[model samples]
Target: MGFMSGEELVVTLAPVAVYWVYAGIYEALLQHTTVLDRYRLHSRRDEETKNIASRKDVVRGVLLQQAIQVAISVAVLKLEGRGAAAAAGDGRAAQPEPFLVAAARFGVAMLVLDAWQYFMHRLMHSVPCMYRRFHSWHHRVAAPYAYAAQYGHPVDGVLTETLSGAAAYVASGMTPRAAAAFFAFATVKGVDDHCGVAAPWNPIQAAFRNNAAYHDVHHQRGGGRRNFSQPFFVVWDRLLGTHAPYALRQRDGGGLEVRAFKPDPTR
Candidate 1:
């Protein structure tokens, strides 16, 4: 809330930084190993799915938006009356908060973000011009990879990512420390949603409904509609009658093939 000391800034930035590294490792492991290949929703990867330029685009967008979030968070925390400026090495205040404090507030923040993002995503799909001008950049990857989550147009990125997280953090009744936790968890979940694997053993998929397979349907829907929510829970799409049911059927040789059937809106 107050001016971020160097140490506080480090704490705030750690989530974004750590998530990137973890996602990179996971992405490579999934690609190089057969242990989880059975979970590849679409056996065929797109030309741009793992392109270096695409990864750079995603990284650029993520870092720029994260910088904006850091600046905005200072103000948000201040408004919450928790942003107290600390003097360097003054020992007058704690250096930074412990992790549990951040974790305790993460769930509320996640729910707020997911709800806001669900509506925003549907709105983008509904507007033809909005989809063409911005959201379509993300949909280019019919079979998306982990880093592809952030590879979106700048305008869309600001609206969906930055705005979603900021609003959620504020609405969570969270302190600055908790905001950091929210960012970290969000970054990780976002990548996992687009990671292109849906192993039954994956705890993320098991814990929440929005697994990699869940989001893969969103990317590969091949239509401009349905399965719009990201990260966790297919709540909005289910409520809106737009959540399609999908299954992986065994092919003649043995691999799995994704098949999505539109849910009858009238049902």
Candidate 2:
């Protein structure tokens, strides 16, 4: 058997491919044109002046993390004998899953991923050393953009993203193909959350409550201390009292911006 082939390759690389294509589209729209200006959560001035990490640095960090993800995926496939079994023509033909079953698995995966990310992400912030060493790199982008979604310390990425994904897949009992799809969907969601655009017409944005505006709050100065749930539901945040409520208001110039508000004490 070659090092990796068939479903193994797809499972390993599909999410990475999806991440770049989705994020690249946002990069092109945000950087090359003024068309999306009205949808932007922050002004171009904020993106340029407030962000500490350069584009080059963000790209390099994402690439490194992706490489690590791929390596870990390959290792998992080898250990599970999945690649070898497929290559050897094991008699078990791939069976089509029932639609309802597939849906259930997807739902379970989302819940598992959200719970894992919520707790792990919260822990990263709760502990000062972990935040400084692992998570702070991601916070460098005060005015986030699409491609900066995965820009973080590799160790942080492995702990929060890579392992959480694996846990979701294992817990949901999803097939490799389903896991691939889930990961790709997650990549798109993560990129959208950081796109810094709250385009009302975006279906993905409309479908999920934890959209760009919600995540943009976490990237702000004081806002990082709350809203730790990510890329999916806000159940954990709400339950844990970490949900920083925010309102999206029209910017003075054109677009929209997120302003977090304190909840009423009596109400």
Candidate 3:
């Protein structure tokens, strides 16, 4: 039977490890900034702070979810190992992908993965039962923080983050190397969405149109029901008419203009 090669194991562990270490530190730093607080979408900082989970709870929950995802990833690698063993026995061989083709395929894979995430995320919130049992654990943070990005019930993690990734890899037909890069990209995307700062320098909100502010609005009790997509691209939410009203920053008044999400037929 096939087994996970040492390289495959490293590939799986590296991304998760980097996220835990790097994102953790970044979240901690941003949690206490004062000037940045003015940019917060919701001005109920005092109220939300009261609702934030204790440090211990956040750490325990995030680590537990991370462990579950890692175990699931390891099992998948073993299955792939078995498939490799079968191919070898049948005299089939694998070929390395050309660089340009690999890059193009990886891009397509992200689209598939993103669409999958949008569907599952909407389902988790749309179905009352699923929301109560599986997705609720995530929303426990009414005001989400960075570590909260990966902090969810294992079942929710499987359906959204894990499945979205596997489907993306398959749909994209990414070579093993491209797949590794996808993991890194996905990790950063998750971190950026939850990091809370939405620093002016972040290109994701501009390039992808969904960032911490877009997602933070969803963390609100009412807004969560409206904005059901995650990770990248609000196009799914826009097309479905589930998108929530958002704020447009005013240059002079330091005020926000409330804007509603509308369907874009052109999308």
Candidate 4:
């Protein structure tokens, strides 16, 4: 995979631009809607205990991770004999042809990442030691907000996100451009999952209604295993019998609640 100057630009700028736009739109929605406000997990109950990290802090954290990743990816590209350069048009190629090719590759990478996230997340939850010791920092945000998505135990973050990216690079043989786009999508999905709004038929919600609900339950319950998947897909959960049933009998007073699955205490 050899990239010219234009491709490199596309690979670099696309993720930042897309995610920034998404964050703005999501925050605006939160400001205006009471329904969206109610969806926030911590609400006033835990507000005093919350640290409420700023958007600048969140961006800084993400950039730190991206810096490390870029260094590693550069090394990998070199070792693989794949060279990357800046793209000509808004970081794309001078011609429209290669851009389309790269776009398809990005689409495939996103699906592959969704699968990888499901596997790794499930493993983290099922493996108790890993979950309690390494993954707990993420769950500490009882009520998650968009920026809260990347708040991870450093080791856990590197292992799950960075290592996964490295593996995807190897497995999919993705170009820098495609990998860049994939990262953008991944970041947006993470933020959206933690955004705390549950609009039915919203594209993100539609992508993972069960997932958002599962995670919400995890927070509301204060301690429990649920939605051990990320990047918004439930195929693996369905396959592995971890998929929580979504339907609930409506109460006489109205409003739906998730039916709890009885856990085998023997485990």
Best by TM-score: 2
Error of 1 at 88 (Å): 11
RMSD for all candidates, in order, please. 4.1, 1.7, 4.3, 5.4
- For 58-123, candidate 2 gives per-residue lDDT tens digits of 999999999999998888777766456656776552665789998999999999999999999999
Clashing residue pairs in candidate 3 are 2-81
Q: Rank candidates by TM-score, best first.
A: 2, 1, 3, 4
TM-score of every prediction relative to native? 0.81, 0.95, 0.80, 0.71
Give one digit per residue, the lDDT tens place, for model 3 in 1-267.
235554466657767887887686765555655555544443445326734566567678777777777777676655555234334543332555677887888778877877898889988988999999998888777665667678777889888888777677667766455567778788888887876555566676667667877787777656666666778777788888777756656423332223445434443
Looking at candidate 2, the ten consecutive residues that score lowest on lDDT are 86-95
RMSD of 2: 1.7
Candidate that scores best on lDDT: 2
Give the poorly placed runs of model 1, Cα more than 4 Å off.
1-3, 6-11, 44-56, 59-61, 65-71, 78-81, 85-105, 251-255
Worst lDDT run of 10 residues, candidate 3, spans 250-259
lDDT of 1 by residue, 21-111 (tens): 8677877777687766666655544434533345666678667766775665566655544435343343424455456755556767777
How does residue 90 of candidate 3 score in lDDT? Answer: 35
Clashing pairs in 2: none
- Cα misplacement distance, residue 35 of candidate 3 (Å): 7.8
Task: Report the candidate with higher TM-score, 2 versus 3.
Answer: 2
Compared with the true structure, all predictions reach lDDT values of 0.70, 0.88, 0.68, 0.60
Better TM-score candidate (1, 4): 1
